[model samples]
Target: MREVRATDLPHIREIYNYYVANSTVTFDEDAMTLAEWRDKFYYLNKQGMPFIVAVSPAGQILGYALVSPWKQKKAFRFTVENSIYLGAASTGKGLGRELLGELIKRSKAAGLKEIIAVIADQGADASIKLHRDFGFDEIGRMGKVGFKFERWLGTILLQKSLK
Candidate 1:
Protein backbone atom coordinates (compact mmCIF):
# COMPACT_ATOMS: atom_id res chain seq x y z
CA MET A 1 0.00 0.00 0.00
CA ARG A 2 1.16 3.53 -0.77
CA GLU A 3 0.05 7.06 -1.53
CA VAL A 4 -2.22 7.35 -4.55
CA ARG A 5 -0.97 9.01 -7.70
CA ALA A 6 -2.92 10.81 -10.41
CA THR A 7 -2.37 7.96 -12.85
CA ASP A 8 -4.17 5.57 -10.53
CA LEU A 9 -7.51 7.34 -10.90
CA PRO A 10 -8.62 5.27 -13.85
CA HIS A 11 -8.19 2.02 -12.00
CA ILE A 12 -9.76 3.56 -8.95
CA ARG A 13 -12.68 4.69 -11.07
CA GLU A 14 -13.09 1.21 -12.46
CA ILE A 15 -13.15 -0.40 -9.02
CA TYR A 16 -15.62 2.16 -7.69
CA ASN A 17 -17.86 2.09 -10.78
CA TYR A 18 -18.15 -1.67 -10.47
CA TYR A 19 -19.73 -1.27 -7.04
CA VAL A 20 -21.94 1.53 -8.31
CA ALA A 21 -23.27 -0.66 -11.08
CA ASN A 22 -23.52 -4.02 -9.33
CA SER A 23 -23.99 -3.46 -5.60
CA THR A 24 -25.44 -1.34 -2.85
CA VAL A 25 -22.05 -0.77 -1.26
CA THR A 26 -22.34 2.74 -2.59
CA PHE A 27 -25.61 4.59 -3.11
CA ASP A 28 -24.37 6.10 -6.36
CA GLU A 29 -26.80 4.79 -8.95
CA ASP A 30 -24.62 6.00 -11.79
CA ALA A 31 -20.98 5.39 -12.50
CA MET A 32 -18.65 8.21 -11.63
CA THR A 33 -16.70 9.73 -14.47
CA LEU A 34 -12.93 10.02 -14.62
CA ALA A 35 -13.19 13.77 -14.36
CA GLU A 36 -15.10 13.47 -11.12
CA TRP A 37 -12.47 11.17 -9.74
CA ARG A 38 -9.81 13.69 -10.69
CA ASP A 39 -11.67 16.43 -8.92
CA LYS A 40 -11.89 14.27 -5.82
CA PHE A 41 -8.18 13.53 -5.93
CA TYR A 42 -7.33 17.20 -6.16
CA TYR A 43 -9.72 18.07 -3.36
CA LEU A 44 -8.19 15.49 -1.05
CA ASN A 45 -4.71 16.58 -1.97
CA LYS A 46 -5.47 20.22 -1.23
CA GLN A 47 -6.96 19.27 2.11
CA GLY A 48 -3.82 17.31 2.96
CA MET A 49 -5.92 14.19 3.53
CA PRO A 50 -4.81 10.64 2.93
CA PHE A 51 -5.69 8.80 -0.27
CA ILE A 52 -3.97 5.44 -0.44
CA VAL A 53 -3.93 2.63 -2.94
CA ALA A 54 -2.92 -1.01 -2.85
CA VAL A 55 -1.10 -2.23 -5.88
CA SER A 56 -0.02 -5.63 -7.10
CA PRO A 57 3.56 -6.58 -7.89
CA ALA A 58 2.79 -5.71 -11.51
CA GLY A 59 1.62 -2.26 -10.41
CA GLN A 60 -2.10 -2.86 -10.93
CA ILE A 61 -4.30 -1.01 -8.51
CA LEU A 62 -6.20 -3.54 -6.43
CA GLY A 63 -7.96 -1.24 -3.99
CA TYR A 64 -8.01 2.24 -2.48
CA ALA A 65 -8.88 4.04 0.77
CA LEU A 66 -9.34 7.74 1.43
CA VAL A 67 -10.58 10.28 3.93
CA SER A 68 -12.30 13.58 3.10
CA PRO A 69 -13.79 16.37 5.11
CA TRP A 70 -16.95 15.13 6.77
CA LYS A 71 -18.48 18.56 6.38
CA GLN A 72 -17.32 21.79 4.87
CA LYS A 73 -17.99 23.82 7.97
CA LYS A 74 -14.95 25.18 9.74
CA ALA A 75 -15.86 23.47 12.97
CA PHE A 76 -15.78 20.09 11.25
CA ARG A 77 -12.25 20.45 9.92
CA PHE A 78 -10.81 17.86 12.26
CA THR A 79 -13.42 15.25 11.32
CA VAL A 80 -13.49 13.39 8.05
CA GLU A 81 -15.46 10.69 6.27
CA ASN A 82 -13.69 7.62 4.98
CA SER A 83 -14.22 5.50 1.86
CA ILE A 84 -12.65 2.18 0.87
CA TYR A 85 -13.07 0.18 -2.32
CA LEU A 86 -11.49 -3.00 -3.60
CA GLY A 87 -11.62 -4.51 -7.06
CA ALA A 88 -14.01 -7.39 -7.66
CA ALA A 89 -11.15 -9.90 -7.49
CA SER A 90 -9.55 -8.39 -4.41
CA THR A 91 -12.23 -8.86 -1.78
CA GLY A 92 -12.17 -11.58 0.92
CA LYS A 93 -8.39 -11.72 0.74
CA GLY A 94 -7.74 -9.45 3.77
CA LEU A 95 -6.93 -6.45 1.58
CA GLY A 96 -9.71 -4.37 3.04
CA ARG A 97 -8.38 -4.89 6.55
CA GLU A 98 -4.89 -3.78 5.62
CA LEU A 99 -6.14 -0.82 3.61
CA LEU A 100 -8.44 0.37 6.37
CA GLY A 101 -5.74 0.00 8.99
CA GLU A 102 -3.37 2.06 6.92
CA LEU A 103 -6.04 4.64 6.23
CA ILE A 104 -6.72 5.12 9.97
CA LYS A 105 -3.05 5.44 10.73
CA ARG A 106 -2.51 7.99 7.99
CA SER A 107 -5.61 9.91 8.96
CA LYS A 108 -4.40 10.25 12.52
CA ALA A 109 -0.99 11.38 11.36
CA ALA A 110 -2.66 13.99 9.15
CA GLY A 111 -4.05 15.51 12.34
CA LEU A 112 -7.58 14.35 11.86
CA LYS A 113 -9.38 13.94 15.16
CA GLU A 114 -12.35 11.85 14.09
CA ILE A 115 -13.25 9.55 11.26
CA ILE A 116 -16.79 8.79 10.20
CA ALA A 117 -18.04 6.05 7.97
CA VAL A 118 -21.45 6.29 6.35
CA ILE A 119 -22.07 2.80 5.12
CA ALA A 120 -25.00 1.48 3.19
CA ASP A 121 -27.05 -0.90 5.31
CA GLN A 122 -27.72 -3.31 2.49
CA GLY A 123 -25.05 -5.71 1.30
CA ALA A 124 -22.35 -4.07 3.43
CA ASP A 125 -22.06 -6.39 6.39
CA ALA A 126 -18.37 -6.91 5.76
CA SER A 127 -17.70 -3.19 5.91
CA ILE A 128 -19.55 -2.82 9.19
CA LYS A 129 -17.60 -5.65 10.73
CA LEU A 130 -14.35 -4.26 9.39
CA HIS A 131 -14.93 -0.87 10.96
CA ARG A 132 -15.96 -2.46 14.24
CA ASP A 133 -12.78 -4.50 14.25
CA PHE A 134 -10.83 -1.25 13.96
CA GLY A 135 -12.54 0.22 17.03
CA PHE A 136 -15.15 2.28 15.19
CA ASP A 137 -18.44 2.38 17.07
CA GLU A 138 -21.93 2.59 15.68
CA ILE A 139 -23.06 6.11 16.31
CA GLY A 140 -26.48 5.97 14.67
CA ARG A 141 -28.55 4.87 11.71
CA MET A 142 -30.70 6.68 9.21
CA GLY A 143 -33.48 4.62 7.72
CA LYS A 144 -35.08 5.01 4.31
CA VAL A 145 -32.88 7.91 3.47
CA GLY A 146 -31.85 6.73 0.06
CA PHE A 147 -33.78 5.26 -2.83
CA LYS A 148 -31.83 3.18 -5.29
CA PHE A 149 -32.19 0.06 -7.38
CA GLU A 150 -35.94 0.50 -7.04
CA ARG A 151 -35.77 0.03 -3.28
CA TRP A 152 -35.43 2.05 -0.10
CA LEU A 153 -32.10 2.01 1.59
CA GLY A 154 -30.60 3.32 4.79
CA THR A 155 -27.18 4.14 6.19
CA ILE A 156 -25.24 3.03 9.23
CA LEU A 157 -23.00 5.67 10.73
CA LEU A 158 -19.82 4.58 12.47
CA GLN A 159 -17.25 6.80 14.12
CA LYS A 160 -13.75 6.52 15.61
CA SER A 161 -11.82 9.08 17.57
CA LEU A 162 -8.13 9.41 16.95
CA LYS A 163 -7.31 11.45 20.04
Candidate 2:
Protein backbone atom coordinates (compact mmCIF):
# COMPACT_ATOMS: atom_id res chain seq x y z
CA MET A 1 0.00 0.00 0.00
CA ARG A 2 1.14 3.55 -0.73
CA GLU A 3 -0.07 7.12 -0.81
CA VAL A 4 -2.36 7.75 -3.74
CA ARG A 5 -1.07 9.73 -6.67
CA ALA A 6 -3.02 11.81 -9.17
CA THR A 7 -2.54 9.12 -11.81
CA ASP A 8 -4.34 6.59 -9.64
CA LEU A 9 -7.68 8.39 -9.80
CA PRO A 10 -8.82 6.57 -12.90
CA HIS A 11 -8.33 3.16 -11.32
CA ILE A 12 -9.86 4.43 -8.10
CA ARG A 13 -12.83 5.74 -10.02
CA GLU A 14 -13.24 2.39 -11.75
CA ILE A 15 -13.12 0.51 -8.48
CA TYR A 16 -15.71 2.76 -6.81
CA ASN A 17 -17.94 2.94 -9.86
CA TYR A 18 -18.30 -0.83 -9.81
CA TYR A 19 -19.99 -0.66 -6.42
CA VAL A 20 -22.15 2.24 -7.57
CA ALA A 21 -23.35 0.22 -10.50
CA ASN A 22 -23.64 -3.25 -8.98
CA SER A 23 -23.89 -3.09 -5.19
CA THR A 24 -25.62 -1.22 -2.38
CA VAL A 25 -22.21 -0.74 -0.74
CA THR A 26 -22.41 2.88 -1.83
CA PHE A 27 -25.62 4.88 -1.98
CA ASP A 28 -24.55 6.59 -5.22
CA GLU A 29 -26.99 5.60 -7.93
CA ASP A 30 -24.89 6.92 -10.78
CA ALA A 31 -21.30 6.38 -11.77
CA MET A 32 -19.01 9.21 -10.72
CA THR A 33 -17.14 10.96 -13.47
CA LEU A 34 -13.40 11.45 -13.64
CA ALA A 35 -13.86 15.17 -13.03
CA GLU A 36 -15.73 14.45 -9.83
CA TRP A 37 -13.00 12.07 -8.82
CA ARG A 38 -10.41 14.77 -9.44
CA ASP A 39 -12.36 17.22 -7.30
CA LYS A 40 -12.54 14.71 -4.49
CA PHE A 41 -8.84 13.96 -4.70
CA TYR A 42 -7.98 17.62 -4.57
CA TYR A 43 -10.38 18.27 -1.71
CA LEU A 44 -8.86 15.51 0.39
CA ASN A 45 -5.38 16.52 -0.61
CA LYS A 46 -6.06 20.10 0.39
CA GLN A 47 -7.48 18.96 3.70
CA GLY A 48 -4.36 16.93 4.39
CA MET A 49 -6.41 13.75 4.68
CA PRO A 50 -5.24 10.26 3.85
CA PHE A 51 -5.98 8.68 0.46
CA ILE A 52 -4.17 5.39 -0.01
CA VAL A 53 -4.03 2.75 -2.69
CA ALA A 54 -2.82 -0.80 -2.92
CA VAL A 55 -1.10 -1.81 -6.14
CA SER A 56 -0.07 -5.16 -7.56
CA PRO A 57 3.41 -6.03 -8.76
CA ALA A 58 2.13 -5.43 -12.27
CA GLY A 59 1.16 -1.86 -11.27
CA GLN A 60 -2.55 -2.59 -11.16
CA ILE A 61 -4.49 -0.66 -8.58
CA LEU A 62 -6.02 -3.40 -6.44
CA GLY A 63 -7.96 -1.16 -4.08
CA TYR A 64 -8.10 2.18 -2.29
CA ALA A 65 -8.94 3.68 1.11
CA LEU A 66 -9.59 7.26 2.13
CA VAL A 67 -11.06 9.59 4.74
CA SER A 68 -13.00 12.79 4.15
CA PRO A 69 -14.45 15.41 6.41
CA TRP A 70 -17.51 13.96 8.11
CA LYS A 71 -19.30 17.25 7.76
CA GLN A 72 -18.63 20.64 6.29
CA LYS A 73 -19.06 22.55 9.49
CA LYS A 74 -15.88 23.79 11.08
CA ALA A 75 -16.78 22.16 14.37
CA PHE A 76 -16.77 18.77 12.66
CA ARG A 77 -13.30 19.27 11.28
CA PHE A 78 -11.68 16.75 13.55
CA THR A 79 -13.98 13.93 12.48
CA VAL A 80 -13.96 12.25 9.11
CA GLU A 81 -15.87 9.63 7.18
CA ASN A 82 -13.95 6.63 5.94
CA SER A 83 -14.30 4.88 2.57
CA ILE A 84 -12.61 1.70 1.33
CA TYR A 85 -13.19 -0.07 -1.97
CA LEU A 86 -11.50 -3.03 -3.61
CA GLY A 87 -11.67 -4.23 -7.18
CA ALA A 88 -14.10 -7.15 -7.66
CA ALA A 89 -11.21 -9.50 -8.37
CA SER A 90 -9.31 -8.41 -5.27
CA THR A 91 -11.69 -9.39 -2.50
CA GLY A 92 -11.14 -12.10 0.18
CA LYS A 93 -7.37 -11.79 0.06
CA GLY A 94 -6.96 -9.67 3.23
CA LEU A 95 -6.35 -6.59 1.08
CA GLY A 96 -9.28 -4.83 2.69
CA ARG A 97 -7.77 -5.43 6.12
CA GLU A 98 -4.44 -4.02 5.01
CA LEU A 99 -5.99 -0.98 3.39
CA LEU A 100 -8.21 -0.18 6.35
CA GLY A 101 -5.41 -0.67 8.83
CA GLU A 102 -3.17 1.65 6.86
CA LEU A 103 -5.97 4.17 6.53
CA ILE A 104 -6.45 4.29 10.30
CA LYS A 105 -2.74 4.69 10.88
CA ARG A 106 -2.54 7.56 8.41
CA SER A 107 -5.72 9.13 9.74
CA LYS A 108 -4.27 9.27 13.23
CA ALA A 109 -1.10 10.72 11.82
CA ALA A 110 -3.16 13.42 10.14
CA GLY A 111 -4.43 14.40 13.61
CA LEU A 112 -7.97 13.25 12.92
CA LYS A 113 -9.87 12.61 16.10
CA GLU A 114 -12.59 10.30 14.87
CA ILE A 115 -13.46 8.15 11.90
CA ILE A 116 -17.05 7.31 11.01
CA ALA A 117 -18.24 4.52 8.77
CA VAL A 118 -21.65 4.64 7.15
CA ILE A 119 -22.24 1.17 5.77
CA ALA A 120 -25.27 -0.11 3.94
CA ASP A 121 -27.26 -2.63 5.94
CA GLN A 122 -27.57 -5.11 3.11
CA GLY A 123 -24.78 -6.74 1.12
CA ALA A 124 -22.12 -5.24 3.35
CA ASP A 125 -21.56 -7.78 6.06
CA ALA A 126 -17.86 -7.94 5.34
CA SER A 127 -17.58 -4.18 5.75
CA ILE A 128 -19.38 -4.20 9.08
CA LYS A 129 -17.19 -6.99 10.32
CA LEU A 130 -14.09 -5.25 9.05
CA HIS A 131 -14.86 -2.11 11.02
CA ARG A 132 -15.80 -4.07 14.14
CA ASP A 133 -12.58 -6.03 13.95
CA PHE A 134 -10.71 -2.73 14.00
CA GLY A 135 -12.42 -1.66 17.24
CA PHE A 136 -15.00 0.61 15.67
CA ASP A 137 -18.13 0.75 17.84
CA GLU A 138 -21.68 0.55 16.61
CA ILE A 139 -23.18 3.99 17.17
CA GLY A 140 -26.61 3.58 15.57
CA ARG A 141 -28.65 2.58 12.53
CA MET A 142 -31.27 4.15 10.32
CA GLY A 143 -33.60 1.90 8.38
CA LYS A 144 -35.17 2.51 5.01
CA VAL A 145 -33.32 5.74 4.49
CA GLY A 146 -32.27 4.90 0.95
CA PHE A 147 -34.10 3.42 -2.00
CA LYS A 148 -32.17 1.74 -4.77
CA PHE A 149 -32.37 -1.31 -6.98
CA GLU A 150 -36.14 -1.36 -6.38
CA ARG A 151 -35.97 -1.70 -2.61
CA TRP A 152 -35.57 0.31 0.55
CA LEU A 153 -32.15 0.28 2.15
CA GLY A 154 -30.63 1.35 5.47
CA THR A 155 -27.30 2.30 6.97
CA ILE A 156 -25.23 1.16 9.92
CA LEU A 157 -23.15 3.80 11.66
CA LEU A 158 -19.87 2.80 13.17
CA GLN A 159 -17.23 5.02 14.78
CA LYS A 160 -13.70 4.82 16.08
CA SER A 161 -11.68 7.40 18.00
CA LEU A 162 -8.13 8.17 17.03
CA LYS A 163 -7.32 9.53 20.45
Candidate 3:
Protein backbone atom coordinates (compact mmCIF):
# COMPACT_ATOMS: atom_id res chain seq x y z
CA MET A 1 0.00 0.00 0.00
CA ARG A 2 1.10 3.54 -0.79
CA GLU A 3 -0.10 7.11 -0.96
CA VAL A 4 -2.28 7.71 -3.98
CA ARG A 5 -0.98 10.18 -6.52
CA ALA A 6 -2.48 12.17 -9.37
CA THR A 7 -1.22 9.63 -11.90
CA ASP A 8 -3.18 6.89 -10.16
CA LEU A 9 -6.52 8.38 -11.09
CA PRO A 10 -7.16 6.11 -14.05
CA HIS A 11 -6.73 2.90 -12.10
CA ILE A 12 -8.58 4.30 -9.13
CA ARG A 13 -11.43 5.45 -11.33
CA GLU A 14 -11.64 2.06 -12.96
CA ILE A 15 -11.91 0.29 -9.64
CA TYR A 16 -14.43 2.78 -8.27
CA ASN A 17 -16.46 2.86 -11.44
CA TYR A 18 -16.88 -0.88 -11.23
CA TYR A 19 -18.38 -0.46 -7.77
CA VAL A 20 -20.49 2.52 -8.78
CA ALA A 21 -21.94 0.80 -11.82
CA ASN A 22 -22.53 -2.72 -10.51
CA SER A 23 -22.40 -2.75 -6.75
CA THR A 24 -24.09 -1.16 -3.79
CA VAL A 25 -20.71 -0.36 -2.26
CA THR A 26 -21.27 3.28 -3.06
CA PHE A 27 -24.62 5.07 -3.38
CA ASP A 28 -23.34 6.70 -6.54
CA GLU A 29 -24.95 5.13 -9.60
CA ASP A 30 -23.03 7.04 -12.20
CA ALA A 31 -19.40 6.49 -13.05
CA MET A 32 -17.07 9.28 -12.05
CA THR A 33 -14.84 11.06 -14.49
CA LEU A 34 -11.12 11.68 -14.08
CA ALA A 35 -11.73 15.37 -13.51
CA GLU A 36 -14.15 14.67 -10.72
CA TRP A 37 -11.76 12.23 -9.10
CA ARG A 38 -8.89 14.71 -9.45
CA ASP A 39 -11.02 17.28 -7.70
CA LYS A 40 -11.67 14.80 -4.92
CA PHE A 41 -7.98 14.13 -4.54
CA TYR A 42 -7.34 17.82 -4.46
CA TYR A 43 -10.02 18.35 -1.83
CA LEU A 44 -8.64 15.60 0.34
CA ASN A 45 -5.17 17.01 0.03
CA LYS A 46 -6.39 20.44 0.98
CA GLN A 47 -8.14 18.97 3.99
CA GLY A 48 -5.00 17.05 5.00
CA MET A 49 -6.84 13.76 4.70
CA PRO A 50 -5.29 10.52 3.58
CA PHE A 51 -5.95 8.90 0.24
CA ILE A 52 -4.29 5.49 0.11
CA VAL A 53 -4.05 2.95 -2.65
CA ALA A 54 -3.04 -0.68 -2.60
CA VAL A 55 -1.03 -1.75 -5.57
CA SER A 56 0.69 -4.88 -6.71
CA PRO A 57 4.44 -4.99 -7.14
CA ALA A 58 3.64 -4.92 -10.81
CA GLY A 59 1.98 -1.52 -10.38
CA GLN A 60 -1.60 -2.79 -10.60
CA ILE A 61 -3.97 -0.81 -8.47
CA LEU A 62 -6.12 -3.18 -6.48
CA GLY A 63 -7.98 -0.99 -4.01
CA TYR A 64 -8.09 2.33 -2.19
CA ALA A 65 -8.99 3.72 1.22
CA LEU A 66 -9.66 7.31 2.23
CA VAL A 67 -10.47 9.36 5.30
CA SER A 68 -12.33 12.58 4.67
CA PRO A 69 -14.14 15.15 6.74
CA TRP A 70 -17.29 13.81 8.28
CA LYS A 71 -18.81 17.25 8.15
CA GLN A 72 -17.65 20.64 7.03
CA LYS A 73 -18.63 22.34 10.27
CA LYS A 74 -15.73 23.56 12.35
CA ALA A 75 -17.28 21.82 15.33
CA PHE A 76 -16.95 18.51 13.55
CA ARG A 77 -13.29 18.89 12.70
CA PHE A 78 -12.24 16.12 14.99
CA THR A 79 -14.42 13.54 13.27
CA VAL A 80 -13.70 11.93 9.95
CA GLU A 81 -15.41 9.42 7.65
CA ASN A 82 -13.67 6.49 6.00
CA SER A 83 -14.25 4.25 3.02
CA ILE A 84 -12.29 1.36 1.51
CA TYR A 85 -12.95 -0.22 -1.84
CA LEU A 86 -11.32 -3.40 -3.07
CA GLY A 87 -11.51 -4.64 -6.59
CA ALA A 88 -13.50 -7.82 -7.11
CA ALA A 89 -10.31 -9.76 -7.67
CA SER A 90 -8.71 -8.27 -4.59
CA THR A 91 -11.47 -9.34 -2.21
CA GLY A 92 -10.56 -11.90 0.47
CA LYS A 93 -6.89 -11.18 -0.06
CA GLY A 94 -6.37 -9.22 3.14
CA LEU A 95 -6.17 -5.98 1.21
CA GLY A 96 -9.24 -4.44 2.82
CA ARG A 97 -8.01 -5.23 6.30
CA GLU A 98 -4.56 -3.79 5.69
CA LEU A 99 -5.89 -0.74 3.93
CA LEU A 100 -8.45 0.07 6.60
CA GLY A 101 -5.97 -0.53 9.39
CA GLU A 102 -3.60 1.95 7.82
CA LEU A 103 -6.42 4.42 7.33
CA ILE A 104 -7.46 4.25 10.97
CA LYS A 105 -3.90 4.58 12.18
CA ARG A 106 -3.26 7.59 9.99
CA SER A 107 -6.54 9.17 10.99
CA LYS A 108 -5.68 8.91 14.65
CA ALA A 109 -2.20 10.23 14.01
CA ALA A 110 -3.74 13.20 12.23
CA GLY A 111 -5.43 14.04 15.56
CA LEU A 112 -8.95 13.12 14.63
CA LYS A 113 -11.16 12.37 17.61
CA GLU A 114 -13.27 9.75 15.89
CA ILE A 115 -13.65 7.79 12.71
CA ILE A 116 -17.06 6.99 11.26
CA ALA A 117 -17.99 4.39 8.73
CA VAL A 118 -21.34 4.56 6.98
CA ILE A 119 -21.75 1.10 5.61
CA ALA A 120 -24.60 -0.20 3.49
CA ASP A 121 -26.57 -2.85 5.32
CA GLN A 122 -26.42 -5.68 2.84
CA GLY A 123 -22.72 -6.03 2.07
CA ALA A 124 -21.85 -4.66 5.47
CA ASP A 125 -21.44 -7.65 7.70
CA ALA A 126 -17.78 -8.17 6.96
CA SER A 127 -17.03 -4.47 7.02
CA ILE A 128 -18.84 -4.03 10.31
CA LYS A 129 -17.00 -6.98 11.72
CA LEU A 130 -13.75 -5.51 10.51
CA HIS A 131 -14.50 -2.22 12.20
CA ARG A 132 -15.53 -3.95 15.37
CA ASP A 133 -12.38 -5.97 15.31
CA PHE A 134 -10.49 -2.71 15.20
CA GLY A 135 -12.50 -1.37 18.17
CA PHE A 136 -15.08 0.70 16.33
CA ASP A 137 -18.41 0.48 18.10
CA GLU A 138 -21.77 0.45 16.43
CA ILE A 139 -23.24 3.87 17.11
CA GLY A 140 -26.47 3.68 15.13
CA ARG A 141 -28.24 2.17 12.20
CA MET A 142 -30.40 4.23 9.87
CA GLY A 143 -32.90 1.90 8.32
CA LYS A 144 -33.88 2.52 4.72
CA VAL A 145 -31.91 5.67 4.61
CA GLY A 146 -30.89 5.37 0.98
CA PHE A 147 -32.21 3.96 -2.28
CA LYS A 148 -30.25 2.38 -5.11
CA PHE A 149 -31.01 -0.07 -7.86
CA GLU A 150 -34.72 0.44 -7.17
CA ARG A 151 -34.47 -0.78 -3.61
CA TRP A 152 -34.14 0.78 -0.21
CA LEU A 153 -30.85 0.32 1.58
CA GLY A 154 -29.95 0.71 5.21
CA THR A 155 -26.85 2.43 6.59
CA ILE A 156 -25.03 1.59 9.77
CA LEU A 157 -23.03 4.28 11.45
CA LEU A 158 -20.02 2.78 13.20
CA GLN A 159 -17.67 4.85 15.27
CA LYS A 160 -14.19 4.53 16.74
CA SER A 161 -13.17 7.03 19.37
CA LEU A 162 -9.55 8.00 18.97
CA LYS A 163 -9.39 9.87 22.24
| Ranking of predictions according to lDDT | 2, 1, 3
Expressed as tens digits, the lDDT of each residue in 1-163 for candidate 3 is: 7889999998889999998988786888889999999999999988889899999999999999998899999999889999998888999888889999899878877888889999998876888888889898888988887899999998898998888
* Model 2 collision count: 0
Please provide, for model 2 over 7-126, each residue's C-alpha lDDT reduced to its tens digit, 9 standing for 90 to 100.
999999999999999999999999999999999999999999999999999999999999999999999999999999999999999999999999999999999999999999999999
The true-versus-predicted C-alpha distance at residue 52 of model 1, in Å, is 0.3
Please, what are the lDDT tens digits per residue for candidate 1 over residues 99-142? Answer: 99999999989999999999999899999999999999999999
Candidate 3: the clashing residue pairs are none
Report how far off residue 115 is in candidate 1 (Å).
0.4
* Candidate 2: RMSD to truth: 0.5
Ten residues in sequence with the least summed lDDT for candidate 1: 21-30
Where is the poorest 10-residue window by lDDT in model 2? 1-10
Listed in order, each prediction's TM-score against the native is 0.99, 0.99, 0.96
